[model samples]
Target: MGTLWYGGKVRTLVNEHDIQEAVFVESGIIIDVGSKELLTSKYSKVISNEVNLNGAVLYPGFVDSHLHMIGHGEKLLRLDLSDISSLVDLRETLIQHNRKLGQGEWLIGEGFNENLFNEMIPDKFFLDEILSEQPIVLTRVCRHALVTNSEGLRLAGIDESTLNPPGGVIVKEKGVPTGYLLDKAQDLVKGILPKIDRKYIKRALVTSLDDLYQHGFVGAHTEDLNYYRDPIGTLHTFYEVIDGESRKFRANLLVHHEVAEYIMQDQIEHDYVEKGSIKIFADGALGGRTALLSKPYTDAPSTNGLAIYSPEQLSQIVQKARKFNMPVAIHVIGDLALEYAIQAIEEHPVPSGKRDRLIHLQVTREDLIDRLKKLSVVLDIQPRFVASDFPWVEERLGEERLPYSFAWKRLLNAGLMCSGGSDAPIEPIDPILGIHAAVTRRKPENVGHPGYNSDEKLTLFEAIKLFTLGSAEAISNENKYGLIKAGYTADFTVLSEDLFELAPDEWLNVKVEKTVVDNTVMYERNKD
Candidate 1:
């Protein structure tokens, strides 16, 4: 039996004017798309159900090109310090959260940006004042850096004598440990923390997927192997949760390079879960002044940034992933890191039918773009960073670097394959917000302010394509997804209003009406 969906503007996204009135789907595939009267008459005999769009608009289902599924779920569970603008509120929130925790439980919080804090750069002394007895760990929004109390440092056995690990740093002041861990150094404290149970892992995955569905995301390319510390178990849990029956969601799993070998050996495959690229971190993040840059930061002139892997080491890692017949998705935030990534990828090409990905090209140069256009790689961009990082980020990069930093339009114009994502848990997971940021190129709250680089703003259609066609292409699923044509998957994101008709500033008010995946209505907005 087939289902007929009609009465709304069906944007196929093949072209600007390719809107249709109806779509007939059967067995999770679109059987036909045309005028409502034509589709209804053609599928009248086989049609078992009909969905009325009620004047809402429909577009190809949105897929987040990059995100951490489990981390997003954990963010929902943990103390979210994203909104803490002052050290006083942070201390109070931690105190209140600590009071609710059972005795001896490790107090963990994520999404604290010192840039938002009035005091700036929190150290061990600030956290120790909250609780000297209980171990506390507060991760920066970038997840590349974290701050802990004295107890956490004691538990992790990190002191003034502790040497920084390879590709990591233990921030210190006046020969004393500051309890701030960057990059690989974060593993020290995390290693000692209690192992997460499989049940919690499953819960987090399920919760995150459901939340994504509610936000109109049909699927996401998520990296979570590092979170659970068990690649095989985590992969299995993903299959168990995203099963086509109970939970109808698509997932492209990016295995962390640290556990890529194990996952490649297991060879577990599923219809709904796809084993995608091997994720590697080339450098740290910009917020912590850790994103590796060719030159020193404008504000922090003492150092350039943190590079997680040298050129040779990065090349070796890429070669290793290639040996496993997998593509490498390297995280590169700074221009220097991008150079290293480019070198690594150039040295070891991805396997046939696979595409290497460079996530977060926050900083770049014209020469880098020219080189990138020649490579078989996709740019996984988080447009929302403009809304969040800008104005403050200007201070880090200075006016000279502004032209090349976060230049999505330039990258696209250069004919580079670019996709969109929220980098959720770091930014909000809403594609609408991402689209808004891409189109407006300004903070949603302060729309009147001219965008940091007003010339780089993308059109509404281009922004929408980033989440649809661009994302599908990132996972090599462009043929089966990202369209409303016959034989394509019957996945769609229904919205309360037509985005093209709405002003860019009003996009924040737009609501997701329904999220359909594989012919199933996974989420529907509550009428109440």
Candidate 2:
């Protein structure tokens, strides 16, 4: 017997058609979709269950194309400093959190951004005053940088004698280490932190998945390779959940470039898992002024930015990924980094059908967008970044580069498949917020700017496709996911209000009333 679901406007997202009637599901698959009258005439007798959508709007289940699942889960367990705006509050929060820690345990926290702080850049002085007994490490909101106290530096063996690594920096003052680590340099201190138990990891993953489900996400294309102490163990935990308890949740994992070789050698394979999309950091982030740029930063002219890998090195890495039948999702925020990535990908072409991805694309020129289109690469973009990094971005790139930055519509017009994501933990995981940002190109708060790039704003339909079809293409799951039609997986995101009735400004107000995955009600608001 199958399940008969009705009572909503079901947007199929295929050919822009919608069904006002019913959808029949059986064995985790959408068997049919039509009107209530016809579905009742056909499947009423055989249906075993029914769902009342309560006149809500139904959309194809949303897919977050880029996120760090384990990292988000870990953040849930750590001290969140995202809202800390002053030194006093930061100090108090850390002191309070420190008091709860067991003796000798390292105090770790993330999501502290100096941009939001009253004082621009932070030093370890204040942290040292509050957290002297136990080592404390606080990662900046960007995740590319971190600040540590004296004890953390001592435990990590970092001192004035410690030289900066090739692609990272150990910020120092007056020839002495300031306990701030940037990019790869963070590994030095993080290496000394105790590993999380495997059981806790499983719990974190579950908690994270449940949170995502509540946000209307059916699945996510996440990179969890280095987010945990045991990357393989984390992967195994994901498989255990998928194969055992949480079969409704779908996750497409990307192997970190550092571990692609090991995965390829081990020949690890699972029904829910696909192999060989290595994540490479071509450059750092724009907030830190470390995203490689074609020209020097307008605000900071001392350096263009940091390039994690040379063009040749990137080409060689792509070649290795090609050998392993893996695609590369290179993080390229600045124009220079994008150019290097494009050149490397061009030099070492993957097989004809394989799709490599360019993550971020925070800063780009018309030429780079054209080149990316020609190369058939996927654009994995975070729409929320436009709303979050505006006005501030103007300072980073100046008026000269502003026109070409965050040009999602231009990429779409140029025939590029752009997958949407929240970059969660960095931003909120809500898809409505992401959709709102993409459609309005404005901040949800409606405070600073009306629109960052009014011309680049996507239509509501187009933006939804980015989270659905575009995300499906990013994970190479086009055939199975991204639509709510017959012969498709029975996954849907039910909204509390009709999205079509709402204006662009009201998109953020729409809530996920219910989320169904694989014909099962994974999450339903107000239902236990």
C-alpha RMSD by candidate, in order: 1.1, 1.8
lDDT of 1: 0.91
In model 2, what is the error at residue 5, expressed in angstroms? 1.7
Candidate 1 lDDT over 342-406, as tens digits, reads: 99899888888878999999999988998998788999999999989988899899999999999
lDDT of each: 0.91, 0.84
Candidate 2, superposed: residue stretches over 4 Å from native: 15-19, 244-246, 266-269, 447-449
- Residue range with the least summed lDDT across 10 consecutive positions in model 2: 267-276
TM-score of each: 0.98, 0.96
Residue 326 local lDDT, model 2: 74
**Residue 74, model 1, lDDT:** 89
